[model samples]
Target: MDPGLLYDLSMNDYLNFLCVSGYNQTLLKAFSGAHYRCPDIINIMDFNYPTMTIPKLYGSVSLTRRVKNVGSPGTYRASLRVSAGLSISVKPNVLKFDKIGEEKSYKLTVEVTSPGDDEAFGGITWSDGKHYVRSPIVVGGVRGVFHVLDKTQFIDLGKLHQQLNLEVRRKRRSKALSQIAFVGVLCQGGTVDCMK
Candidate 1:
């Protein structure tokens, strides 16, 4: 979706953005005095924009995503930023590749331990210092531990927060409709809302 979603364009069952940047820093380094021929491309795996719902808290919730490097092999760093009322983390904070097109799995876990009753928001940013790619995340306020059968659907993890209480309140269950998922600008720098 790097150049597809308009945030304005509606694709098949998914939102679109005019442009997106999963931090592919090729042009940004081209002007350097030294010869820069390597391409550092960081891609978010199976990322669905707008936002994703955990469905149920049940004490803890976890998700996995795959990120692959299609450019020159190098090391890319992964960082997480989340909201309150939950505890989120990712495995292997530092990613390295010996060859191109290599992929890695990121296991993100979330645990709700606060009684704040406020929604949680955050994301995981993969950066090579120049290009910063962030997948935004927002977790709605929950009320209690729940178990709903047959309501199965999930997406990738972005941001995170909190990690203390096991007595999490269940969130509201509404069947209105899923949110319109859309990607923002494929920015290739620091954390900020951007589109181009």
Candidate 2:
């Protein structure tokens, strides 16, 4: 039911509280830094004072906690010299999105191309040369062959419809005009024109 059990933290968890004195104190002085002063202790028997090693003691101590798994990725982080009598515990390190593959594959393909100069190759020190590079050496252009399909392969409705409609309209208009013209000529020529 405990969260620690779920993470298997209880299996290989290690807790160490280390106390050092004398030469070690010099090394730890920076770690204590402006914080916890060793506590003064009093004992009834001859007023025996608690040594710096005791719990209510002066000076500083370091506590280190390390947790790891052989099969899984473990977090290891440290922040030195936080507050006096206060030690930092860093757990569960985070991985950034950039570290993981979260972006779509299409997003990675876009980039810019910068121009470069040939003089730079001859040992010429160009200014702002850091941004310049041999302009990506574009080798070839996109080349492709196109083939046209035969006209007989398809009966194009658009062209066929236009041609048929044009012919029919022309024939109808010509027939109507010819009939009108013949009637006009016959009327002008009198009744005998009907025989022709």
Candidate 3:
């Protein structure tokens, strides 16, 4: 089976394939348990990538804000917070709308301290003490620390089967041997290799 299929296959599909391929019930159960133990792959779906385009590190972008209120005037403050490996500065962080239909523009500058495959995500929040609004700030061309694993490696059934079998055998042997070795001794009563 193609390695790509491992990533694309749902849990049910994977289990069904295993069953159809003549894998015993015990092996199927073991595979299911191992699959559940593996950490979930992080993907772009895990984070909010706003549609708005942000500049690369050490670059600047202009953002416009317009306030329209037919009833009363309010003061709003703007602030920015970025993820690690990035810094942000907003030239006029605070905005005051003295009247209705007031609009303003600010220059936002970003600096990247570390270059790597990690995503930089943050938000620009505007608040008037009574109400608040936020816009997503995203820095592209970078990946986050938690990222999708390489599906190619994940889909290798032969390697996966070998690992599962080894683990199952180790577990089965350890339980029976521990009782016969020593009650409370290091190396699990010599069942485990402590010197090597």
User: By TM-score, who's the top model here?
Assistant: 1
The runs of at least 3 residues in candidate 1 whose Cα sits more than 4 Å from the true structure, single-residue gaps closed, are: 1-52, 144-196
Best by lDDT: 3
RMSD values, in order shown? 17.5, 40.9, 20.1
CA lDDT of each prediction against the hidden true structure: 0.48, 0.23, 0.50
Candidate 3's residue-wise lDDT over 65-159, tens digit each?
A: 33343324676687777787766677687767676545555555555566554567877766677655566777774422222223343335335
* Residue-by-residue lDDT tens digits, candidate 2, 1-196: 2111011122112110112133244444455442333323312111111111112211211222222222223222222222222222222222112222131110001111221211111111101212111111111111122122233322243345457667767777654433221111222223433333
Give per-residue CA lDDT, model 1, range 71-161, as digits (tens).
5666768787867677778787777767755666666777776734567777888766644556666666544453322211111111111
What clash count does candidate 1 reach? 24
Model 2 scores a C-alpha lDDT of 0.23
> Each candidate's TM vs. the true structure?
0.46, 0.15, 0.41
State the weakest 10-residue window (summed lDDT) of model 1.
Answer: 155-164
